[model samples]
Every structure is written in C-alpha cells, then in structure tokens.
Target: MSFYLSLDDVPDLARGAAILGTGGGGDPLIGRLLVEECLKNGKKIEILDPTEIDDDDFVIATAMMGAPTVVVEKVPAGSEAVRSLRALEKHLGKTADATIPMECGGLNSMIPLVVAAEAGIPVVDGDGMGRAFPELQMETFGVYGVSGSPLAVSDENGHTCIVDTGQDNQRMETFARAVTIKMGGAAYIAEYPMSGADVKRTAIRNTVTLALNIGRTLRKAKDKHLDPLAELSAFLKDTIYGHGTVLMRGKIVDVERFVRDGFTQGFATVESFDGGHEMRIQFRNENVIAHKNGAVVAIVPDLITIVDVDLGTPITSEALRFGQRVAVYGISTPAIMRTPEALQVFGPQAFGLHEPWVALEELSAAR
Candidate 1:
C-alpha cells in the first residue's frame, strides 16, 4: 500500500522519530519546519512499503551527516538532499527509483521525505536502522553486507563530493565526517544504493508506520489524560522494538560534554526528585550506557531515550540540560541488532565500554 505524507503528519512523525532517535539524530524541529514549508509550497511526498517495491528498483538512502548542534546552526539549502541524490545518480549512471532514509531518527527521517517530495520519488516505508546510531557504518544495511559507497555529500553552497570508499564503510564514514566538518559541520548525503530485494531482506520493515503509530499513541494519550509513558510502553510490546522500561525519572543534576573528532561526547547525571538515587547516562551522539548507583542498568545496542515526563516528547543528547526533569526509557532494539555479528559493530565494546552485551529484558528483570 502507498500513502502520502502531508503537513498534518509532520508533528506526529517528528515526535515518533525523536523517540526512536535514542538521544541522537539531531533535533527534529528544523527538519519539521523545512518539511512543512515544502508541503505548504504544494509539494507532495508518498511513502511506499518495502514489499511493494519491485526486486530490481534502484533505491538510495539519504541523510545529513554532522553534529546535531551544527545542523541547527547550518541549515540545509532546502535542495541539498535532492542534490546529493542526483549527484550520486549521475555518478552511478542511473537515476534512483526511490529514496529511503538511512536511519529513522530525528532529522534524518524528515530529510528523505523532503527529498522525495522535491525529486518526485516515493520514500520507502522502512529504514536501515529501526532506531538511530551515531556512525554511518552502524546501519542494518551495512551489517547485512551492503556497501556504503558511491556516496555524494552536498553542502548548502552547492559544493559536493562524490565518494567511492570501496569496501570500507568505516573509511567512508570517516571521510564523510571530515568533509562534513569542513563544509561547516553538516552536509546532506546520499549513498548505499541497493536493489529493492536487498532492502526487503536487510531493512527494518514498517518502521515508518511504527514511528507514526508511536506518535499517534503519544498524542492520543495526552488528549485523553492518560499516561503517555504507559501507552508508549504498551505499543512497544507489540512491535519489533519489544518492551520499553522506565530506567529512571529525575532532575538532571550534572552534564559533562565536549566536542572531539567532530562528534559530541558526554555523560549526564539525573538525580531523583527527592535527591535519593541518581542515574548516569553516557553518550556519543546517542546514549551508550546507563548506570544507576554504580551498577550498569542499560547498555548500547538497546535503545536509551530521554523524554519530557509531562508531554512525552523525546530530548536529544545535544538538548539535554541541567535542572530539567525527565524520564529515561530503555526499549529493546530490533532482533537483527541482537545477533553476535551485529553486536560486534554496535555493542558496548564498540563504544569503548568493557562490558558484555545484555538484553534490555534481562536488565529490566534484574532491576
């Protein structure tokens, strides 16, 4: 089935994408406004289910690469995403049949929509990651053997770089990061060209619908004066994301952050309202670990998200602040991410934590 996305869907879609962003993916605010403007200008974007695509359709994934903080200051030129896609298509000697989001989180989710609208191509209803990660190589597509190359990076000033990093997705990511930094810290990117059949086999299916469902659930809960967290948890139980657990609810007491390697690295401490217990979250774009009273509570490859308690809105790592009251939730990642091979790429070890991988369910049960 195919469906069109309108301005009316932006709010919910943005909200849901933020929740799945796991504290990264940048702020959805800028992306939302950009998308809304496109829609108001009479542009229409359609989303196609992965299963609906023909086996040989040429699909390219597009997104922005840089610090979320930088993306806000250096907004896209409104055509950067499409430009990058077109550039890559030209380099590949073929036009893309459709566009897909590299990941379904924060602003990246909206980028593909805007590009699809401008390019008159349908956006695939799935993504490389069901949730967000900090690096380009951390996608399910990459994990399942898809190359991340023949990429195009475009800046607001019309500057673009066509990259063919051979078989090293990591090298592609490193080069792209450096290019993004030099391009003023953010650049629109289009890469990972793959057949529709490959996408069906590797991508997380129905994630766009999942994000929409989550957004709608949160909105409906607020309207009905129900517990949005409970509603969110209930919805997760029925999805590939599995169960969601409230890791802690507290006021932020401290935050340590700095920029290194063109990325934001940091840790935040959230103390209970009564000042009794405290939880610490470490992050690299996305939350990587959670520790409560000196014991590990949650780790990477599982989803760790911070949400405004009252409104159910997700707060990205860049936006976390001291003195803010929030609730942290741990949601199980997709099953594909739990495999031994997948863990090697995104596990705690990959993030520099010397801890064995543990499932969110097990951690919650232990708690």
Candidate 2:
C-alpha cells in the first residue's frame, strides 16, 4: 500500500531515521527541517511501494555524502540534493521517474523525500541499505548488481560533478570523496540510477514505512509513559531487523570523533551508572563495531544505536557528547544483508575490523 506524508509525520520519520542510521547518515533534524519546509509550502509527498513501479521506470537514489560530524555545523541549503538530481538527469538525458533513498539513515533517509517534493515526483518506499553505511559503494544496490556511476555530486554553491566510473563503485567513492572534500567536507549525491525491476529485486523493501512505524511506536510508548526501549524491542522483532538488545545503560564518559578521509571516525565510551560495565563503539560515520567489557558485543552490518534513556529518541554519532545519559541498543540486520556477497561489501572486515562478522543475536547470547 502507498501513503502520503504531511508536516506532522516529519518528526516521527526523523526519529526513526536516526535510530536506523546507527549514529551516522548525517543529522535527521536537518533533513526533517528540509522536509518540513517543503510541506509548509503546501506540497504533499507520496511514498510509492517498490512493487508499484513499472519495470522500465527510472529511479535514482539521493543522499548526503560527508562526515556526519561536519553536517552538525554545516546545514545544507536544502537545494543541494535537488541540484545533484537535476544534474544527473541532464547527464543521463533522462529524468528520474521517482527518487529513492540511498540509505535509510539520518539525513539520507529524508533527502529523497525533499528531492521528490521539489522535483514534483513520488519516492520509492525502499532504500539501498536497510540502515546506514558510510561509504558510497556499500549500498545493497551495488552489492546486488546496480552500478552507482554516472553519479552526481553537488555542493551548496551550485557546483555539480558527474562521475562515470562504469563498474567501479569503489573508484566512484574515491573520486566522489575528493569532490566532497573540495566542496567543504560535505555534499549531496545522486547515484545508483536503476530501473524499477532492479529496485524491486535489489532494494530493501518498505524500509521507509518501517522507519515511520518505528518512530510511531516509540512516540506512542512515550505518550503512554511506557518503557520505550522495551516497546522498540517488541516492535522490531517482527521486522526484517531481528531483535534489539540493550547493550548498556549509562552515561557517555568520552567521545573522540573527527572528520577523517571525508568520514567522521571515532569511538564513544559509555559506562554504566555504577561503573560496573563499559561499552565502546567505534565508527567511520556509522557505528561499525562495539565492545562491552572487552568482548565483541556487536559488529557492523548489525545496528549499534544510542537513544535517550527517557525519551527513546535516537542520538546521532556527531551529536554524542560527554555526560549524556543514554541506552545503547544492538539490533540484527536483515538476513539478506548477512549473505557472503553482502558481507564482503559491508561486513566487519570491510570497515577494517580484524574480527570476523558475528550475528548480533549469537554475540548477545554468548555474553
């Protein structure tokens, strides 16, 4: 089924995007504001289910490409993504039938909505990555078979570059990162142009709806003065993302994050209120690996998210600070994302972690 989003849904969507982002994908607040601004102008955004698209319909993915930390200080002009989409359309000599999110994390989740509204097009209800990933080539679209090239990168000042790397998605990331850094450490990107058939086959289905549902569940739980974490766990058990586990409930003792190689690279340390336990999560934009009491509790391809203990609102990686009381939750990724082919692109080793990838469920049980 299809649905429409109004201004009222922005907050819920943003909240869920942040959770799914696992501390990356840029700030959801910024993306939320952009979508709100669009809706405030009386424009309605429609979300089309992947199955609704015709086989030949052209779809393009839109997202922010940069250090999430940098995005905290540098808000977008809200037109950068639209510019990149238009530029990509011109380069391909074909207009996009609809826009899809490159990843369903943070700012990237909302970017396609903004672009769809501005371009007067609908958005597909699925994304390349079910959650967030830092690199361009890590998308399931690339993992399954879609080429991310003929990609467009644009900055706030109207400069746009189209990268045609043929089949080299990694090279696309390399070239695009250079342009992103030159554009001031952050830029908007339009990549992975694909047909409706490819989207149906490769894209994770219904994640936009999933994000909205997660947000609604948390919001409702809070409204009822219920345990939001427990509610979130129960809600996720039925989704593609398996279960959610509370890795630690504590205050942040330290956070060491900085923009490195066009990515926000760092670690955050969370200590239990009584100091009985500690968990450290490392990231290259998105939370990749986490250790609790010196043991690997969760690793990449699985979600490592931090949310407010009281409200259950997600905290992005760039926003982590000392003394913030938070609860860290580790959720399993979908089975499709754990396959041998998928792991090679986004698993623990892909992010430079020497340990082999382990399912969050198994790791949590062993602990």
Candidate 3:
C-alpha cells in the first residue's frame, strides 16, 4: 500500500514499538522528538505492509547503533539518518522501495519515520527482528540465511563504509563496531537489504500497528493514574509475561561508570525498600545481571527492567544511578530472545562471563 504516516500516529506507534521491544529497544523519547522535528520540516513518511510490494522489491532496515545514553545526550546529527538511506540507495545500484526499522524498539522505531519522510519512500510495516539486540549481525535477516554484508554503513560526517564480506556477517559487525567507535561511540545506520516478499516469511507482521496500540494504552493509563505496568502486562502478558517479582525494590546508593576502551562499563547497587535487602546490577549499557543477597535472580534475555514505581517509566541500564527508588520487574524472555542461537549470541558467557550461561527457560521453570 502507498500510504504515508503522520505525526498524529507517533504516540501509539512509538509506545507499541516499545512493547514489541520486549524490554530492549534503547529509549524512544529522544527519537520521538527528533522525528517530530523532521515532520515539522515538511517531511512525509509512508507505511506499507510487506505483501504490498512486488517480490523483486528491494527492502532495507535502518537503526541507530551506539550508546543510547550518548544518543540522548548528543541528539542525532539530524540529517545523518536520512543521508545514510540515500547513500545506500546510490551504493546498491537500486533505490529501496521501502525502509523498515532493523528492529521495532527504542530510537530505531522512530528513526525510520523521519528517514522515510525525508527520502519520500514508504516505511515498510515490518522489521528484521521484532526486538532489539546488541550486535550487528543478530537481526532475523541472518536467521533467514540473509547476510548483513553488502551493507552500507554511513555516519553523519559523510564518511561511509561499503561492506560486503561475502558471507561473513561477524566481520561486518566488527567493521561496523570499529566505525561506531570512531563515530563518537554512536552512529546512525541502515543495514539489512532484502525483498519485500522475502522478509514477509520472517518478519513480524502488524508489529507497527501493535506498537501504536500499546503506546495509546500507556498514555491513557498514565492520565488516569492507572498502573501502566498492569496495562502493559495485560497487553503483552501472553507473549512476554514473566514471573512478577520485586527482585529488590530499593534505593540506589552508588553508581560507578567508566568508559573502558571506548565502551561503557559499570556496576550499581540498590539497597532494599525495606532496608533489609540489597541488590547489585552489572551492565555493559543494557542490564545484563541482577543479584540480591549474593544469590543470582534475574539474568539476561529476561527483562531486568527498572521502572519508577511512581513515574511508571523505565530506567535503562546505563542510566542507573544513586538515590533512585525503583521496582525491578521480571518479564519473560522475548520470542526471538529465547532462540538457542540468540541465547548463544547474547548469552552471559559472550559478555565475558566465566560461568556458563543460565537459560531463561530453566530459570522460569525452576520457580
């Protein structure tokens, strides 16, 4: 379908996108602001279902990769996202019929709205991964036997890298990460290239519509002072439900952050709300592990999200701090997150752990 999305749809779409993010889409607030700015400047975004395009139509996925903390602080260079799209089109020897968010979460979701509007192309109502991941080659496109190589990664400075390792996506990941390191630790990018028809079989259908709905629900719940968490639980419980645990309802006492070797690293401790219990959180940007009383409770792939009980919003791993009262919720692992390949890809061991990774499934069943 040849349709353009407007600013009015941002709220629901962004919210719903967060839900599909299932606990890991970076953050959407800044992306919404940037997208709205683009919209105000006479940009237009079109949305299309995967089936709407011909089998031969070229499809690409775009997302911003880097420290989410850095993204919010710097704001995107504005034109970088759109320019990357245009640059890829020129490099591909074919203009993309559509651009979709590489995944439907955080800033990536809203980035496409602006990119599509500026480029006058339709944003396909689909994505490579239904949720966010921490790697370059971890998108569903790879699972479907598609390679991220032949990828064109462009930054805000007109510096571009044409990547085609001919079946080596990890090399592409390494190459892109090196670029990201030089791009001030955050770079706007559009990667996966596929056919409208080819992606339909692997892409999550109607996710954009679902994201819009979730956003609306959260908004209504907030205005009414209803439990936004409850509203979210009701909306996605079946697909993303996990054991509801307070983990350690506490106040953060200290936070230590260091940009070690160009990547953020740190640990935080939260003293119990009851003042009798305490917990420690470790991270490499996103929450990776949570421990209470020297016993491991919540682990990766499971939602270790910290939300302000009163504010009803999430606090990301990088931003965890001192003197903040928060509730840690244990949400189920995302569908894509549970895949053996995925667990292996983002497993605890992969992140420099000496211990074997604990499967979320076993963790869930044990309780």
Best by TM-score: 2
Q: Spell out the clash pairs found in candidate 2.
A: none
lDDT of 1 by residue, 23-44 (tens): 8887888889888998999989
Model 3 Cα lDDT, one tens digit per residue, 64-168: 877666665667756777767777778878888878888776677888877787777888876765555567676667766677767666666777776677677
Top candidate by lDDT: 2
TM-score of each: 0.98, 0.99, 0.86
Write down the worst ten-residue block by lDDT for model 1.
Answer: 69-78
lDDT against the true structure, per candidate, is: 0.89, 0.93, 0.69
Clashing pairs in 1: none
| Regions of model 3 farther than 4 Å from truth | 1-4, 12-27, 51-53, 238-248, 354-367
What is the Cα-based lDDT of residue 306 in candidate 3?
A: 72
Q: What is the C-alpha RMSD of each candidate to the true structure, in Å?
A: 1.0, 0.8, 3.0
